[model samples]
Target: MVGGYVRKSKAKGSSNVSYSVTCATCDEVNILSHREVGGLTLPLLHSSHLYRVHDVHRTSITATLLSHMFSQSQGRAVKQQLRFYSSANMSVNLEGNIFVTGTNRGIGLELVKQLAEKTGKEAHIYACCREPEGTSAEALRGLATQYPGKITIIRLDMSDEDSILTAVQAVSEQIQTAGLNLLINNAAINKPDSLAQLSATGKKDMMEVYETNVAGPFLLAKLFHTLLQTAAEGHTSEGDKMSCRRAAIINISTIISSIEKCPETFAQAKMYPYRTSKAALNMLTRCQAEDFKIQNILVTAIHPGWVRTDMGGEQAPLITQDSVHGMLNVISSLSNKDSGMLLDWQGEKIPW
Candidate 1:
């Protein structure tokens, strides 16, 4: 027998009472409202009947029920699955910092993982991607579970100005709690083409790439400059008059952008768009670094080495983790004395 207890609902001026029925099976209780039982009665009569759903809610419910069916008791359980996930690429954790960007599958994704795993320092990695539900982001969710309170995922497409603005607003809200320290510009892309092919595509793709890779980082830095400065000003170090070390901006760049070290192979390969965009980025890094000099913000461009991510491709020499580790070594070794200098992964200054 399906033994149960029914709780009658209390409503004013209503005789059609609402009741919740609790059924015990093997000493485990399952609760359902009378209305719910009524709906199920038809399914019991027609064994072929199946409930259908239209969207994510249905999918989540199905997955949740399947999980619960295997459990010993009909107890309510909060799903351990992550709704969102992210990683802030970091090598070593000097302090708890906030990192944000899109397209985490390549360099961006690797950076976030290394930051959390290698640094042994607390990090709040805000990793945004074009599709939060995409398979590429699933590994990130796993990372979030591995390190609770360490990562967050959001939808961010740098090409979309509104999304960029929204990401900044969210970061502003988070900084109130954890306090942001380093803002790393790690997300970048290149439209594969020669100068001849680029000319055919005209100014459109060029501007789009620049908007995402160059302008977006500049705007993000500008919006958070005050917050970063404030956070930095709160901490103090030995041999420092100020209460805190100034916040730092690490602008991820490419060696192809270096005018002094431009490889002949790159030009022959026709990677003009990628190279020029980063060159512009390097200049912007210089400008911002100088602008915030008095405010105690250290900004510099860094060549992370040729890494073997999607952008770097299989032929690229350096591993993503190795490149990031080298870069972190440079960052950790930096003194106020080294501010504003363009550096390579090895910590040597790159000629502007």
Candidate 2:
């Protein structure tokens, strides 16, 4: 059995709508939002058919469902709104102060670069890395230089607790009481370890990876809880809504973290250290999502896919920009319902 719930909101010069369906056969709820611009409706894919959708464009039912939603939303009162409708590679307008860790290279650098392109002077992006002056972060430095006042490069070693506290203090002093809009825990370490290499050194490597991947994010969230809450509180009118335009914690996870899919993936290469650590990180995402719900701070795990980064290697299929682009769309379209879920770069939920 399936049931539908429709909601809409008007923002600036555009009309946004959300039509969600609850299915007994599928996951609990799937939300598909849309934007109306000059009589044209652009669909924002936020489907709940996790088992059915592995790719965004492949979901045939998405258009049909949006078509029905548009028809149903006519003459509806503006009691609630989804606020934004976006797709992969689409333009997005984000407000408030944004923070991202691991901005030196790979997806982190790409995220900062793309964000700087979208953000204006009114907004600020704090791009954190282990070394702001290091040779590796030269590109990030150049980006910060390009953006000037729009982007601040902060020194943060995610594995070090003192460094996290220092980073938090630095960010807090700059944003004042306005609070942080987004916290992307994009910094992570994937120390190479496998079942075939089980030894003291491998076990040591596991702990180091876990410390950076799981424990670092945990401390960062704990220290920045106040800033996140302040940001969320700013949207009192839309307190019920969860959005990146407000307060959100985006953990840059990987689909390789999926334990259920391990049978197929493990055969390819048993990335024991990286996989297990990310699995723990997913748990952190869920716990934070639950704990921060009343505060209206959204938290979710996102699998950025196999990208051609230093970590992903040259043979990896997807480009960093493409993965970040898709992730931005997914992050922009997140709602209260998405908290605690594990979603891919394409906005489809991944199995635990």
Candidate 3:
């Protein structure tokens, strides 16, 4: 429960603020040497308290910085004040590259907004959509304008192999070698369908849905695998617990896709194509986790719940903000033990 930062006096004849943190375990002060004032959250060795560790330029997290940021309550939700502090303008040293799909609207847009709002200026975000300059991406454009270089909007079409390749190459160029820390396969599609609607064209509808929801994620993971691997290997310690601190791939999956729980959920809706494709996506998540774990990359599937969004009808109980808020927290706390599992926005495990 002990947390807060103090502003030290300005350096002689310098405009930059002199920032320091008193190690909670031993009051050993660590001065933040940066071009300007910024902050990062750190729990130093033998400390029961949380301290903010800030720097304008963050070299790396697992190398010489605070190896872990969790408090004693690792299993519990992070305190409200900490979350607020992170979302505030104060810089957090999450200096890594992140790529997200379907950035135009809905959950993808919310993810991009929250990521931009939460992480520090050091984090580079590539917001990918089918039409980066098209009319649909105006809000995304606004975000790019608002945050300046913090986010880069890239053109991506989940269903198209060539477009995905071009996006990968562009993103790889922007990020230094082995620096893609997070990849979120959040882009997806859903259309009206039922078993009764499964005519020849309905079958084609199923294939189309599969192309975007299942195949897109699969291809992205395959192409980005080595970059993700290199990022993980740079950590230099396999003992480091799996987190976004390590390279991570978060596949935005759904609860309706759970085969064991389908009987309980079937009465709600019967969108055949959407349901089947997500089921396939879940399998992809499991397969990726198995393949990537040894390389120190963390992969998992998250169900954002039936939120009130373009795809999730207005009648749904959850809102986009709350769902994304919980999801970001869950993602931050993931360890190797949780890899390959299906988890909810609150970090609760779901039956595959």
Candidate 4:
């Protein structure tokens, strides 16, 4: 008795009875004696046996039972679809409105490119860069053309507050009520300087680096706080109890920022200005993670490895695609538990 309504009858001097159930999906009638049903009631046995024996979508069965049990409950119609695939070939799709900074070249540009390739058609990507006419910008524009409406190039000079505000306004107009699901604080600058150079410059290089690396993300997060909150709110409105949707902020930090792991041999050639600013960025990430917990926003710091870009130089050990790909996988798998952590491209935790 697996799919239909159950009726009970008492038998004289015997505790056993017979019941019949009709499968909802296959409409097959099954008759079972009380002894065969074991300890389970008729309805429970029917539901469990039908699910185990049939290939019906699990969600469909749950929805049907809920609807039948609460016919007057006015539940919304549910649609169920199932897809089966091998674990070896699984691919994750990143959905929602995404905004990435420093996208004219290097890691930021690569992130935009790969996101376009991996996400669904409904995904909207806003690629931000300071110079729109540069060679790297031209390449990003080509990607925009290739992807049609999925990619948009915006001007964002992270060092300038006016430019940041303007870019935020533009993104706000585009996203409107949908809000931004992801914000990547990837724009940064690095000027190689030693202790000797710092003595002559009197904090000028440090100030410049801090402005773009630390202050930029701080201002950007402050300005976009509402939009991120809006995205989190929208996730709750979906009415799906199992939904893991959330808004996230990713800070592109570096492994060189690690104070504990800095090589003793390279102390003289240390880029102090760059390293200190990134360390400060990591601290900011921790603060944001704590403050944004109530809003359900995930904040994290990631080191993109030594990628061979304009900043990383030609001799760098890692390539742009590999670094970006690994970081994307890390970002896709992040949960609230991973917030405030300093992780490398491989998703391994790095010591502060």
TM-score of each: 0.68, 0.74, 0.73, 0.70
Compose the digit string of candidate 3's lDDT tens values, residues 1-352. Answer: 2232333445668776544543333344446553332223321211122222432233111112222323222222222221222232333334488899998998889888888988876688899999888999999999999999899999999999999999999888877585788999999987653323444336678888999999999999999888887788778775656777679999999888889878767666667888899999999999998998878788899998667787776545456766777788788888899899999876878897
Please, what are the lDDT tens digits per residue for candidate 1 over residues 209-286?
Answer: 798889888878887787777766666453232211237788888767877766533543456667788889999988
Deviation in Å, model 1, residue 134 alpha carbon: 1.7
Candidate ordering by TM-score (highest first): 2, 3, 4, 1
Whole-model Cα lDDT of every candidate shown, in order:
0.61, 0.75, 0.73, 0.72
Single out the weakest 10-residue window by summed lDDT for candidate 4.
45-54
lDDT of 2 at 306: 68
Estimate, for each residue in 268-330, the C-alpha lDDT of model 2 and write its tens digit: 446678888899999999999999999999999999876678876654545686677768878
List residue ranges in candidate 2 displaced over 4 A.
Answer: 1-90, 193-196, 199-201
Residue 57 in model 4: shift from native, Å?
39
Using alpha carbons, what is the TM-score of model 2?
0.74
lDDT of 4 by residue, 70-174 (tens): 232222322222211112223444678999999988999889888898788778899999987777699899889999999999999999999999999999998
Best by lDDT: 2
lDDT at position 169, candidate 2: 94
Q: Regarding lDDT, does 3 or 4 come out ahead? A: 3
Better of 1 and 2 by TM-score: 2
Model 2 RMSD, rounded to 1 decimal? 13.2
CA-only RMSD, every prediction:
20.2, 13.2, 14.4, 19.2
Model 1, residue 34: displacement in angstroms?
Answer: 74
